[model samples]
Target chain A: MEGPPEIEKREFGVGEYGRKIARRHLSFEDERKLNEFLRTEAPFYISYSVGYFKFPSATPMENKVLLGSDLVFEFDADEVGLLSERDVWMCDSCGEAGFGYRLKCPKCGSSVRIEIFPDPEREEKLKEMVDALVKDFLLGDFGFGREDVSVNFSGNRGYHIHVRSEAVYELDKSARIELVEYVTGQAIEPQYMFGGVVPCGKDTPFLCVEGPSPSSAGWPGRMARSVLNALERGDRDLLLRAGLKRKDVDALLANRERYTGLIGRGRWPAPKMFPLEVWANIARLTAPLSGHAIDTQTSADIHRLIRLPDTIHGTTGLVARRVKDLSSFNPYRDAVALPSKEVTVRVRIAPEFELGKRTFGPFRDEILQLPLYVAYYLIGRGVAEWSLDSTE
Target chain B: MEVFYEVPFLAVLEKRKDLLPENPSNPPESVLKAASTHLRSILYGKSRPKPVHPSVFFTEANLVAFSPSSFLWERFARHYALLAVPAFERREEILLRHYPPSEVLSLKEFLSVQRPFPELKLYHLEVSGGKVYLGRRAPLFQASLLYRDILRWISERVRNIVVSGSLDDLRETAQRVLAPPSGRKRGYPHIQRLLNVTGLPDGRKRVLFYWLIPYWVTVEGKTPEEVLELANEWISRQGGAKIYSSWILSEAENVRSKGIKPWSVRKVEQIDPELVKLLRGMGAL
Candidate 1:
């Protein structure tokens, strides 16, 4: 029942496989022709695939090779891959001549995968912050020159600032951490406390410093006078008769937020009524001991406190001297509670923006920096358009 | 006509996946033994007439063998299209004038020479079936004409075998020597089995072979030994050279022991550099 099957023979006579397409293999004559052609063509953006590291700004097409119709390797966007065989080279260090995204080293034949991708949004923010920091503080603070600094997008989010400065490169880990904290104006590690000053006389550091206990430290006049007067009365009964309740006195002695807010704001309604009790509590809290607080509120007297030099741990140093109210501006208690405390204000600033295929910044800048807090706010506000860009 | 038995089982095995022979009990029990006598003749340089089977037949086993997709694509370009063309259907213009318009059009279409690819358009030249078609600068053209090369290799191998006429003489001499000592051997069934009309026709063999080769190489998963043995058997039966066969056997052994086979994309801690060089040489990497 089977019909006769036909068989045809195809034979290439001679000299047919002469076309070489790899850019790496092109002769001088071929290069001239290709250059001429490319000169007339418009260049589009090229997106290549790199497993570990990003390509060096441009496609190094001169070192490239192609596997015939099996793989079309060219300058990234110059070829649209409809053909079954084409692999994009995003990084020069990790392609066929090195460790391709597949994890095999082409030269040494090692199994390694590299990390190279640009983080768009993070790079932008880091660039913004670094530029501001550099422009404001200059590289001297980090022991670096402008030329020694380089910026790279981490290929997902966040930008990495590589300071190749010889001064910074040699610094020990502790110094580097200190410098980073100073430049970023954030809390340093090994201690999680913030710094600020209690308002006092216009010229006083105690007027702005708050931490440990500031009231007990012979923190200067007007502020210290009202505080010490409360303390000098011989008996608690006499101090109480003058003004503050024993409980309020105890709270002030404990350096509680409520007591700090009251004194820092100068809204002590009963300062005269319980003069002795108030001064007594303030005197006890502000006493500073040998490198640590002996008296509760007294040790908080210093505007800046650190276990090491140039490493201030609390909020007392960062705030401007003119900011007399440490009580309300403390980020820990007030700024955080603001949104819930002022829901109307929260709803007003909830608007977001879309820029160049990414969305960010409907929330306040502080909210965006906190790890879990940003995620929580993002989800709570129904903001899915943005994602976190981490540096570490 | 004679090919129905020997040369065509590969394609048939591919089509009827269920009917494939299981691996015989242990090493040395070759599935290639089914076509051993024919294979021996091929290796020893004996011209075979129309085979009892197609030279490379479909097999169900092949359907289960796995190969890289790129490798499969190469095989398709190299083998399937050209072999499937009709033999007797020759255009007088093409045969005599050698620059037939139809052939030029088909070649242009197949190579996609006029397509928008910058490299393809800039580099490739069409010269209407000539010697300049197979040089170093024109790998695409050469690859496209692989069917021609395979067909030519087969025909030349067959001619050499036929001119020697050793298989025909060997069979005759073996018949006389291996004839049964008793005259009663003459009573045994002497007729070769004829084709039964109840199954798939032979005309569909070429199409079936094309589909099966890729499926076997790319989809049908096979252990390294099995794949190497199969490829070895296939190449040898097609009158492939000893160097190619020996290389395949050695490479299969290397992959088995190391687990980091050459021309393979599987990740492993270590791979032999020589294997990579070999693959590159074969243009398989």
Candidate 2:
């Protein structure tokens, strides 16, 4: 569950100022209501429920109003573990560009700071998250058809995917959490498939052990396939990264054909060939690789109010636009909401930020004219002020 | 709970040759050989599986099957952990006492009387005396109890199971089974806040009422009568001008026919004050 989306907007001129935008539940499955809310609350950032309610206006809070929900997955750059450069600050005193958080410019031997923003063009984590949600978990394991899923940029720091089918909508909060756990591979334990021992026979008390066949279902199959992939491609580094020792990697490579064949049939060799722990280790190590960076708490929230499609996210003043082709759609270029014409603004401080085709400032207490989109963005960020001329 | 996968029965048996039952119904050696090899190739080999079922490829074998480990989890949920405790009565007798036929949904079709999934391969393990072993006489297990199957069970129970309890009990059952939390309101401040708004226009006055309702009827899965009762209950509680329940009932009908869902909440706060509240509550001040 989440608190309501923000309806308050802050505009910075001489200082920060507030605009009281009434929170309206638009897009309530009624076209006319959506249009009205948009017209009335046009300029304020809009957020919508991931839930499908009985009364969209009643607000999706109590269990009663929430009829069903759309499966939403979030990929935030801050959470994705990608160190994409946010914004670079330059030392105006020394004309030197800065990279990290510092109070002044290092070029002037002073501390200068760097502000991080998601680079629209180069978020490979987006690709990983997409593949994890759409290809691996949803369609591959859960057997959801392609028509059931939709992927789009979150329009700010990340992307969001919506799995909307009769199946998805019917899922309750626990089931959704389970799905999140499955997709992220958080609950995966290698022991069931590889480590723990189960009886081979009822009569004979003989203990037997084996691993998942490469084609097994669920995480077992996925883990086996991932290991097989590393083995088949002779990815020594990948195997080593998967917690295998150098000698173990060499052994796996040496016995590649036999091992692959055995693993194909749900059998692993005697402990003499490799320690029993190695199989579990392979499973433990590889399951995470199949997992992608998804913000778990947010996605699992059935009562969440997600940013409505085509609405502007307050952060960058960028439209939380749906990306038709995430690979091709650049947020810096396509998601910009304001006009391109130049507007004058006074910057107290800002990191060097970019938009569309133009790069703006590493402005520190300077007056300059920038693109309207850029000015709105700076003001939205609360770093710049618009001072009126006092001629009259 | 029961777990099912689409591996061929014979293939699963191949790993546990000793567990094979006498007078098995497996196809002839030639059919078995061809089908098992094909299934293995479909899974183990590099080639992606075709969209066709294994039955389509090997009509005679019909070797495709689902295996279940246990339904212990479902039983645990059903009996509210009572099944875990030992009693003088037999387990079945105890279960019968708790889930009488009058109260229980007759979802026998899911058990194996119908071919909802593939063939069966039960020979699951027994963990007695801290040693892993198999049952002496392993019967054929049918239901795979995948996540969807569990959901099907929940919905079936909610829609059909006869409950003597009040609407609140039924609603609680739906919430508990569907969401199954630890019953902590700690994680539910958002749930509380969602209904925090009060004293609104008629259209929005029943926000909390609309928020906590549950569906009972089968077709469309939503009933208008319950909507009327809940709307009136909420209306009676309000101190302001009387709001007509007829409007909500008609509104519910309009929503039903139009294929649109009921009302939803839009967010009001700009920042995640919940995070701030959490931080402050933790004595970070």
Candidate 3:
């Protein structure tokens, strides 16, 4: 298996991997020095922010002045509960970690970090979200060509999509906000996008229009597709299960011809007899699922410092590898940066996780000889420690 | 409140009618001409008009004809500097020349002009006899008054006379100042004052509170802490409403670091008690 080149064993302080990397390798005195460092290290991740450092060096104070930062969007599988089936989440505060999706630390009410166990389903979902963001939003909406965009596996639980277009480089906070809003469909007025009124018989109230136009792009197209899927299902109970009301479902079924005709024309006209609430509910159901769930704060924050591409993720011991082609990129395979040398570790707690092609156990308070990457991953996540005798 | 100030230049010129050349064409025109000439003499040292002070003298006619000495010029410039329409066309040129170009007033520049006045008082008892003065009813008329008042107050306090402009021009200047270079909007004075006092930037402040009828009411205290306490008490009485105090404090810090006027509380009601408390803690307000 392709992996990082072997390095001589060196003792590093606990929780000092980032600092060690910074001290030994980071020399950001000038552009040439920084570029040389970046090239030499070829870090899995590389982040750059102009005017971010107070002292203008690799080692900057915590309170460094950040004037502005390049735009970043993180799609973490943990955030979307991709590893909810079998994962351990530990709270940094109060030391509460266990199997399953724990949003907050039960002991101290702090957010828990997920020790993600790779699941194909979750990984697929993460890929789908990233693909949608890049293809649909970035390329389609923002007019960014494939060359203008770069995708990278975040090396832990997510994907990071970076746009290096000259067009987006100088966008201010408000402009970024506008871009985020477009991606998130924040200011999309359903009434304006989908609402259409058609006159029915005088006895029957006028019908209100809903659903997307086939020609219309983005949410409207996705909405149309979703509506068509529901129509194709043609099962009332299934529609109801999808959060449509019984009355609306019945109305839709009764006027299937009219509805499908409208759908063909890229619209849905509901009988005025149906409550506006029902139409709204139906609209909600038909709207596209949020595949482009971006962190609004990161996008809106013009001065945000983000993870550098090609840098090692300290928590996962995996490389944040940049992907030229997103379609065939598998983070598990491509982003595995650590060497496969086996190492013994005493795991305090670990849920079932997959690394490379093999699966590891749901270990608890057990000393096990594991692959170096797996052992380091556990150690890095603070779920396991190096076996005392083995280290000596 | 309807406010009327006795035209001090007109009053001074009326007082010094004996100083004028005999058979002056128009009394008001003669006063303005004399005042302009006097201002030019002081500024250019009795030299003929050159492009010496383009801001103060837009035309050669203004430099040649209007010299009424420094005293008369000071009195005239105080009120007529902001006259909506100058009584004479030459007067308009002088008024326009006295103020900086509207395009130059960035947020930073505007904020710099806002310093020297710790608090903006709406009705200065001495200036308006405690009754409110009404200027031409516009969106930014009150703000223009506040701007003029702050300039006048600052100039007097510093023993230097800063140039003033008309309500409409001030409004435009504020619009240019507060508006982003790209997405410009109509500017309001009251909103600008609130932004300055609260230490919020132009972008954030414009969205808060309705600009019509100033919502921030005045409170008198010997110290800012005392004023803040009073403001806090008033807010607490409003029933457990959480104001965005932390956000405001962060913004205040940002403004301070930019070397702009630090936060101050001009109106108690517009501020959240928590913000007042934070400001007091930081020694900002």
Candidate 4:
């Protein structure tokens, strides 16, 4: 039993007046309650520690065998020797826990591709622990005065104590890992972190608020399919023919709104089918075709139709734009003018748009009064039809 | 309104010094259609000017080329009707009333408006056959520069090129034509085909040239047959119809054998929903 921290904490009664508390750190009882609740009710599983290992852990299999069930399956690790000493893995799947690694989830069969990092709160605790240790090392061992060590609570799990003193950055791999191992509750050979322990941490949050339950989040895929079939095949009477009541449809609509309402608030970044930007883009592209109102059927279609941008860089600054002030003036528009004949030699300052900044001309009045459409046409056409730099 | 018949519709509209008195009756579909048709015919050379050498034709042509109507309808008209125009038209009174001159606005200041308009006003200007009120009226030549830059912008954005070297030769030629050399002879059909090069004094010629580059090089796919079809259609009604040489056809044939043509131009007998879905999947839209 831990007392409340030295900082302020807030408690609230959430849905159904259920009590929820948030603070700098969870008490043991709080952790137990939250963990139990999540384990029992959450559709997705949660994970704790994450790191690369040279070889797969035989402990899981050993435990499975001890339990005497066919629950465990084994697959060769990516490399045979010290195979676990590789990339990190985080499981959100529902499957019998085993020693073998899986790229595809065993339970729901979803792709296991995930962005994982150290846990935040636990990482913070580790950081505080590390700071104490580093201070002891500097004063007691090195005989140097204590200095400010910045701490990071990796957004996922685990903490990193960055010692800013001049001596720390110059530390060799063996020495650095020694310091880290002294702080963190793990022991590893210098050979393991030979490449040098690059101090990286999860910089983003991981917890996701649960959206609407499956049945409520748009007519279930099955119902939506039936509706689509009816529309495609001209079976307008299918709603009545199938005996699906308006109440059932209404239930689906309500569920969709609940899910969308949560999604629209900008909480989760990369949800299974609802990455915020992808979600918004989908809604935007489909909204017009969905007609004025967004019904369950349309919502279902929107979910199915929207896709991530093809290029990774396509939406790099998308979020920034969303947050940017929209009432500003346009620099591009302000640059307009009728090109004169004196500036006949039109010099496209980085015409290929390769130049980060575009400056039109030093035309000695030789420029032509190009219409907006035609100018864009040339620029566009040039990009499409011509290569500024030819591989040929 | 019909005064735009011989002129590039965009050229006339670009020179707008005054915000026309709010006449709701103007900008009718029929007017737009007629303007677009004439503009297209002249640009495509469907309405040729007069007998002249290819050089003379290119030099003398007032209109650029290509009908933007099809493009307007296909790409943005619906978006405008449903999203852009209506959204901004809500403030139409303010926009029309407060329309400032270009001189009052600077490039950086104008680009700053990208936040709210999100390229909406820019796109409107790109597609607008009617007058675009850009603050106060600047000189036609000055405004034409703006148009040229806008075309360059839209082209770059629409294409979304990743690598510098991947640009097609046609696009290269268009880019190259932005400035003509001192000794450059006029009416070179191949050169005129380049968007940047314009021997013609008419701003419309530049617009038409750029428009055709996409249709011929990107969308219609680089077959000589398609290019010839477009070129022939363009020159059919023009008085200078004789000036259109076999160069367009010959270039198409040459480009076709190389098999480097754009997929957008390919003729498709059928475009089923599945194809649309596939394209959507590819993020082509």
Fnat for each predicted structure, in order: 0.00, 0.00, 0.00, 0.00
Candidate 1 lDDT over residue span A267-370, tens digit each: 33343333433343443332211111012121111111111111111211111111123222222221221122211112112224332233434443232332
In the order shown, the candidates' Cα RMSDs to the true structure are 37.1, 24.0, 21.8, 36.6
Assess each prediction's global lDDT (C-alpha) against the native.
Answer: 0.28, 0.50, 0.49, 0.28
Q: After superposition, how far is residue A220 of candidate 3 from its true place, in Å?
A: 3.0
Residue-by-residue lDDT tens digits, candidate 1, B185-260:
3321111111111122222222112222222332343554565566545544434433354554455444433322
What DockQ class does candidate 2 belong to? incorrect
Q: Note the DockQ of each predicted structure.
A: 0.00, 0.02, 0.02, 0.00
User: On residues A339-358, what C-alpha lDDT tens digit does candidate 4 reach at each position?
Assistant: 32221123222121111124
Candidate 3 global lDDT: 0.49
TM-score of chain A of each: 0.22, 0.75, 0.76, 0.19
lDDT by residue for model 4 (B138-168), tens: 2222223323333443356433332222113
What TM-score does model 2 achieve against the real structure? 0.51
lDDT (0-100) at residue A364 of candidate 2?
Answer: 77
Kindly give the stretch of ten consecutive residues in candidate 1 chain B with the minimal lDDT sum: B188-197
**Considering lDDT, which of the candidate structures 1 and 2 is the better prediction for this target?**
2
- Residues A33-66 of candidate 3: C-alpha lDDT, one tens digit per residue: 5456556655434444422333333233344443
Assess candidate 3 and give its TM-score to the true structure.
Answer: 0.50
Worst 10 residues of 1 chain A by lDDT: A3-12
